[model samples]
Target chain A: MRRWLARVGALTAAAVLIAATAPIIMADDLTVTRGAGDGGVAREREIRDIKSEIHRLEQRVDQLENENGQLKKSNAELKQNADKLQTSTTQQLSEIQSRASAPPSPADFMDAMNRFLGRYRFTLVGGAAGSYIYDRKSNTNTFALDLEPIILWQLSDKLLFEGTIEANLPAGSSADYQLPVADFQYFLNDYAELVMGIFDQPFGDWYEDQSPFWVNRFITAPLPYNVGSLIPPTEVGLQLRGGFQWGEMGQVADYTIWSGNGPGYTNATCGSNTPPSPLPDCSTTTALVGDTLVSDNNIRLNTHSPGFGGRFRVYPLPADSNFGRLELGASTFDGKWLDGFWLTSWGVDFNYFRDNLQARGEWIQTYRQMPQGLGADNRQGWYVQAGYFLTGLQVPLLPSELDQYIDRLEPLIRYSGINQRATVLGNVITTPGIGFTGSPALYAPHAREVAVGLDYWFAPSIVWQNELDLELPRAGGFYSDTGQAVGAYPNDRAFVSQFAVGF
Target chain B: MSRLIKFGMMAALAAIALVPLAPRHARAAEMTPAQQKRQMFRRGAQLWPIYCNTCHNARPGGEFSPTEWNMIIMHMRTQANLPPQDANAILEYLKASR
Candidate 1:
């Protein structure tokens, strides 16, 4: 019985201990299982989070790569642009240098000038002459130099102003200056023009066309158009002039009409003191030759009346005809002289040029009504001139060097005459280029002259001219009451040599 | 009649006669540039001697440049009473020849 009790108590104690230990073990096991489950869930959540993060990081890296590619493309475009700009700048610099180095062409220079000033030009045209004269009757020799300057100004397309200044210098004499022409012209159309101020009178062709030192064939003018002739060489006037094609055959016609101060008259009477019984009323007679003395006004010297004149010219042949030009002209001038006396003049002229030959002629007639019933003083004058250039002659046998010189030679001839009808006051005239000395052939009522000339042309408008003139008096002799022989003047001869240039 | 009145009448008659001979602007405008230039040159050659020879010898065309010819023609137009058409044609010829 005692052994069984001991064994049982031991067994109980052991069982109690076992039970406590078992409970502790069971609790520890449950805690371990729960911890294991929780740990597995936490690990799964972390793995999912990590996978999402990796996806986001990959997207960010792709974005960085795209940005890098864009940067590279922009940089390439910038470089191309810079290269183009540099090339363009270099080309421009070279062009500028070349332009700066080259000289401007004529057209370019003209363009530059045109920009500075409107179309304008300045030029000088003139003639110069040196002459030596030998007079037979007076046994005198004279040397003279003349200069003429012609200026033309074009104000516009239709307006023009022209002037001529003539300067004459004779050896041992004071210089004389004359304004031959100064005029303003306005074109009415292609065919008509109006001229104002002093101009060459449109009378015969001599004064208006052929009086220039370089143009005239001889040093001296013809007898009819000399300084003491019936009409003045120039006049202050208003003129209407023009030319036009007349027909389909190419004929041309020109006309000129002018109004100016008329001629004057002078009469000589015993001046305050009467001469001795044999002086024949008056010692000298006064005559009115030309009315150019009073250029400023028409009232001086009884030249109040206005003169009317006109000229008409016609060219029958075609302008391009091989025969050259043939021109025929008619002119007339009529005016009132001093004391209401009539002074009328008419002229006809012809010019023909063919090859190297030129021929021209003029006839002029004037009638001056005298005061005190002295009757009309009728005057007639005529001149014919011809010139032939040696170039027209074909001389094959001449040496080549001599041909050039021979071609420059021209021979000219002119015959001029003047007839003055008797005046009741004893017809007496004062000659030009000579003092009031009594010269028979020059001062005679009727006179004739023959002039021959030889010209050597250095250029188109420069020439050396040699001329000889013969002056012959016509009609019967006349003697003043003082027994001075006026018409008994013997024939006279003159020689003149001139060097002229027109530039 | 008074002398002035007579002269005026004469001038009037002359102007009347010249009206029909005026240049035809319409005809000139209708031509081509080349044709107009050629015609002008021809007309200038034809009229050169007729006008220039009346006073002095005709100068050579090569003596002046185009600009110089223009000035010379303007001067001669007034001095010689040349019609505008003739003057212009002469200028063209001178320039062309040079």
Candidate 2:
């Protein structure tokens, strides 16, 4: 039994060993078979397929490694580029900050000022004159100096301010100062302007256009434009004036309408006592027409109503025609001088310019209704003037210096007259006190004058003028302040020389 | 008479106020800048003597600087009651001559 058991154990062990070795033997046998037949070929084909896949996988792994290396290199390059960009940006920023803070130079300031002043302007312009006068009737020789300064301020395209001051100084007399013009003008449109303030009344062309010393060809004004004339020299109020093209033929028309303080009358009653030497006697009542620069109608007669007037002028011919410019104008001013009395004045004027010749004329009529059935006071004045420049004359025979002066010469002639029908106080007129030699002639009932003048222009605005006048008065006489009747009015001859400069 | 005068003044003022509202003539065709400048110069040349000679002799353009001419023209504009177009034309003529 022991032997059998031992043999069984051995067999068992052998069996176990065989059992383990049998699969190896069979795998060896199977490999041998696969290598030798169709199944072996199929097994070899499968191995080949697996090996090809392994080769492909190896190639993919190599490709992935190369791509990863390239990506790392690109990342490094991008970091370098970013660092360079940041450095450049920092340098540029520093340079820009360095130039921002600095002071402007003078040239820069001037440029700025020029830019600012291009639209607004302020200027000063004026006229100055000196004159020598010899009056035959007064038997007096006098010297006078006059200065007129005009200030202009252009605030904007449509707004402007203009002011003029007239200063006159005469030998042996106090200096006279007057504000002739001070006004603000606003342009409403191309054809209209609204003016406010004290301005030369648009009664006639002479006062508004040619009254300045440098502008007037003669030294003395026309008869109608003298002090206390039919028309007021200036008015304080509002005016609308402008010019417009009238027709396609180049004709033009201008108009001015105004409302302001007109004229007033002062009724001075002689005192009960025999008046002072210069004062008129109590028997005759003197009425003074108060139309001076400082007299306002409201203040003089307590009349609250304002004066209404207008002037309309038309140029019938083409303004640019070789025939020259001809203007016809009509003006009317009507207002109440007293509670129930009215002072009405109207004027017609004409101006003609051709080549070197200028001709102008004015006719004015004034009617003042008297109170207490005193009837009406009528005054009429007219003046016609002409000036011709000697530019067309060729004086080759004269010396060069004289010829030049002659070429600059202008000959002027004027015929002026005034007719006062009746005195304010019936047929008897009281003459004002004799403050100067020619005071009586100023109140003449009928006066006529013929003036001849010659003007030498040093420049367009500078001239030396000389004028001679022959005055003739009507037969009527006036009562002096002493209540004495003075005989026929005196005829006088006067001469005036003036040097004027306008700028 | 006073009432008549007041009424006339009111009518005149009303007329003046209504002038801008009145229908204006149709403008010509659009002008080139050069053409417009030429037209302005021509008009100014025509008006220079007509307006300036009315008061005094026409001053030489060289008598004043361009800026000075501006102020002077502004003064004369109001003094002479020249329309804006006419004044501008005169100014342009003066500046160009200068």
Candidate 3:
């Protein structure tokens, strides 16, 4: 704007010069044509007239220049105002956007409650499972259903809470109940942690999230971890665990240890002596009465026991795309039976996973020293299972197929074995109130079985599992609910189906 | 002399109780993904009693970022219903770790 005004001023001065000179040149041309029409006095008068006209033009230019200067000042102010407004608008827009999207930090936790000023989470996990088991006493097939509803929430970072409500669909029996497995862990670093409340004591590969059916080629968790009735899981207490990453040592090597209230598995047993070999409820009174078969801790050790367990894992060729994981773990529980005598159970477990071809198995032995006259019960069992995904088993599917049912469909088979001497694995204690004492032997009559399952993960969050199981009895392999050496081994066949969601 | 004696006693207590805590506080430790993730939120939610579990019921998605949520929760940690770590885990679990 300032420069424009300067140009206007220069143009005005030049126009005045031209206007004043043009008349003189015209007068000279006239004098040449009129042949000296007037003397010096008339020529001089014409020149003065031209000068007067130039003066009037100069006055007009001065007036125009003053008006033009005022106009430029106004234009400059308007431009300045416009620029300021644009800057203000841009700043306001950025402020609004910043308030809308990004979390207050480099990392953010957002869910329904995250939007609000509190910690919150809502989860619903409802699924059904059917199991087919062959019982030697009934010599018939038995089918049962398992339905579970899951709710997990976080009120803050240091705390976590999860509740699972389970029920049997058809009967809607009292089998359904709510259990809270909430924990608060203190983080010392990225690798070590301390936890309190009810949580799984990290014992071995099987005790963690490793599902017998989903991992590598194994169709089942090995004998030692599952049956020792020993590897206590999900306890209510405190746990201290740390993970060490040794780049110079190996690619994937981790260790975890936990010491807490060692609780047995769902409806499981933690017995040192025979839980008074639960009598065969084969009796007609299936309806549970008031505490006739209540658990009688035969040993002096209280039902609430103290135990510590750990797992060590090593990955061979860690940096390589194709590698294997070798894990070895062990656990022990010392508790008494109803008779109040000390009894101890200890077991070792192992599992190996390599790509799609995976194999896992564990061997565990349980010994029972009966109080007074009753002979000591000593037994151990182990099962090794290997499975391969027929469809490039280990390799994850393409991006598009990730959520489809076909991606989860894999054919798997596994085999497990047990020692008859380890009667605890096969014996079922009849809890007068809870029905069957969660002894493994009563639910499983045969010592060994080969199971093949067809699995389909319908979606990343939903899994549909089906397994056809074949239990073969060795020539002498046979036991009744009484733990009696039965006449001969009888085989059982059935199919089991399950659904699970992780969200 | 009595004030000096009191200071000495206090200093002695501090020296004894703070020895183990000093190392852990000065240096942050490393943890497994599950542990790293599962533990920090636990420590962060130490405030819940005075903040949550009053009239605003904890449904599904209740409140706060894992970081900010920790602040609101640390204020209410001691309540029996909303223990610090337990409350924090409930919130962190709902929020995506990513």
Best-fitting candidate, scored by lDDT: 2
Which candidate number would show the highest TM-score if scored against the true structure? Answer: 1
lDDT of each: 0.70, 0.70, 0.44
Preferred candidate (DockQ higher): 2 or 3: 2
Q: What is the TM-score of each candidate against the true structure?
A: 0.75, 0.73, 0.54
Of the pair 2 and 3, which is ahead by TM-score? 2
Model 3 - which docking category?
A: incorrect
Per-residue lDDT, model 2, residue A131, is 80
Query: What does candidate 1's lDDT look like per residue over A265-362, in tens digits?
Result: 43433322223222234334444222111222232344657887988888888876777888898888888776577788889999999878889999
Write one digit per residue (lDDT tens) for candidate 2, span B1-98.
Answer: 75487458646754763386432223423777777677778888988988888779898787776777888887787677676667888898997786
State chain A's TM-score for model 2. Answer: 0.69
The digit string of per-residue lDDT tens for model 3 on A221-278 reads 4434333333344555665444333442223344444444433222223222223333
Residue A231 error, candidate 3, Å: 4.2
Q: What TM-score does model 1 achieve against the real structure?
A: 0.75
Q: What's the number of clashes in each of the models?
A: 0, 1, 80
